[model samples]
Target: MPEAALPEPVRKRGRYRRRLRSRIIVSFVLLGFCLTALFAFATNWARQRVENQLVEDVMNRNLDASWQSYARSGGADVMAPVQQMRAFLIRPDMPDRLNSLRRDFPEWERLQDGIHNISGEDADGKPFSYKVGVRKTPDAWFFIAYDMSQALRGEQQLKRALFFSVIVFSLLSLVLGWWSASRVMRPVSDLAARLRAYRGGNAHPEPLAPRFPDDEVGQLAEALDDYSSRLTEVVQRDREFNADVSHELRTPLAVIRGATELLLARPGLDEKVLQRLQRIQRAEQQCTDLIGSLLLLSRNERGQGSSNVARVAEQLLESHRAQLGGKPLELELEGERDLVVDAPEAALSVALGNLIGNAVKYSQEGRVLVRVGAGMVEVIDTGPGLSEKDAASLFQRGYRGTHAGYSQGGGIGLSIVSRLCTLYGWQVSIRPGDERGVIATLTFTPG
Candidate 1:
């Protein structure tokens, strides 16, 4: 699609699934980073606030209890079950002064420090400064210690949730990608099917069903229709020209043949008359050959109806072999015998006949080898090898090599052979015979 044609918003909406997924991931990560940072900082600040409040509450409770005990019962067991009660506010350590008091006259001096904090942060093991609690009691000391291990663990769990979200989003991206790609290709695939039908000689491209009437692919389909129409026009014109030429030549060839035959039938012609008749006969023969060749060429160019290719191959081979007139040849038929091709019987026969005939004409005493395979017939001639130039242009229309001087009709046979081969979607090759002779081979392919 043209970039300018797509609006900025539409262009930004990428159809590429992988790129879309990557973009989603990047956005997710950015959001996650900002949220995680804000949340983590907020959580730490809230936790610190709660910890300070808890420490203040603990100090006030202990001081009140100690003062009541000393005033009412003269320093009774105020911090009853000291080990359990002290663990609530103090770490598993005691200063030298507090230890000495606990062994002798203990009246809650540890709570007298007035609630204070130790050096450390609540998470990631960072050090934090201390804070003192309300200093109402001179002998009591208060301390605060915050462990952020729990907060860190909570953040890790949040990270795990984020990762899980990413995975879910990625899967959704995959499904979206597949659906988008398939939708885009649907029109193109339909256009291709129509083009294939047109190529197979079915309906014209213009009449083919349009998959998407207003899309770029629809425009391509229209172009194909235009091109196909022009091609059909050119082909019809060429066929008409061929038919006209073929029809026009027939009448003159008939007159020439009739005149030549009448001259030959004259009774007891003198030497001069006989020579003239012979010349006339030669002229008639050339005219007949030319007319016949031209007619076949025209029919081939105009395209003949397809027939049973296997039957054509078999029948043409049998008839031509018999016509070879006792020429030494060996036939090798391999692959499937049910091989079928789309071509006229007559054109294929003429092409194969010419190839075989040339091989026999050049074979001398060596056996002519004919091999039949799937859509292919090869004729090998153990005769003079072909030159590089002859191999290249031997199949060209009316092209004849030096060897044509020795072959009949000055090598028109090979040129005709090539035309018929082309019409039938077959290929012909002439190369060194692998010994001291030439090899002429024909290979056919599915049209």
Candidate 2:
């Protein structure tokens, strides 16, 4: 079965979805986010380490000073005081408040040395944070508490700043990334636009190297210029060669056509001789039509002329019928009259001629019908039906069908037809007929 064609806009959308701009933007966003997040995490960790060290140092110094004052005062109950700190001696007869803390938090009493963080409520039932240093003498233990509420608030403020900075930097990175991508792609976009605007014919395009800086884009421009120059030379050589070959071939075909017409005009010719002359005439005509079609293809341009498709089909059928050597096959044309198409008569004749000729060549004793309708010409042949694989690749160059056993062809007939249809903005499709044989359809676009 033939595949359905997608709409042009949908096809373009699929192609655009994978464009480089989106990929570049996504890469930039991920990079910026990862870097900023790492920075924020490291900032928080460093701040925590420094703040804890300073708080522990302050608690240790104040605890040592209070202990020194108690010793100098000869173990006085009331010792020298310190700012934002309080010292306590834990004994069996300690106050209920201090006893309650040691009972509730066993870890605090278990501390042999060093500083610790403690969380609790004050007498007014207000939440508070503090750090403590525990010192154990021979007969007594000293616990010093330093308030940490201010330091905690400061840490919270720093954390808030770092969080906002991450958000702000990420957004800034996104903006900068978008701007950078636009700048990076500008030259490439310009190059593409210029390429799209180019209309190729006999003239070569302007050099693009001089228009760009000596960057990667500039190197690309230079490469494109060099390639275009070489390709132009190749196309020019091909055109000259085709023109020379077509000219040289025409002289011999003209001579053969003239000689055959002269011999056919003679009266009372033998039946065998007449048939041979007619066949020679048909062969010359086919050659001439083929040459014309090939030259048009080489030029890659549509010929400016209108021809009746039915008339062309009828002529092709008649020509094929002349070459059938006593074959029992019947050729018929069943279509609307005067179905004109906007193309040279020779091109149409060559295209339709190849189809009708193939049908006649393959069938031994069956009928071949050419039907012309609204915008289509279908050649229905009663030959063996084509396989799915053969139908898929039938139009490819040098690809013969599975049933093309010992056929005298190079497999270029359908290839030529397909090329001609493309040049003339037409479509050709081959599919198996309802039960047997193949139906080849040439659908022409209305101008």
Model number with the top lDDT: 2
Give candidate 2 regions above 4 Å deviation: 2-18, 22-28, 63-82, 102-114, 117-141, 146-148, 326-328
RMSD (Cα, Å) of model 1: 13.8
- RMSD in order of candidates: 13.8, 3.7
lDDT per residue (tens digit) for residues 76-105 in model 1: 334422222342222234476456647643
Q: List model 2 lDDT by residue over 224-278, tens digit each.
A: 9999999999989998999999999999999999999999999999999998898
> Candidate 2 lDDT (Cα, whole model)?
0.83
TM-score of each: 0.45, 0.85
Angstrom error of the Cα, residue 77, model 2: value is 4.7
Superposition TM-score, candidate 2 onto the true structure: 0.85
- What range of 10 consecutive residues in model 2 has the weakest lDDT sum? 1-10
Residue-level lDDT for 260 in candidate 2: 96
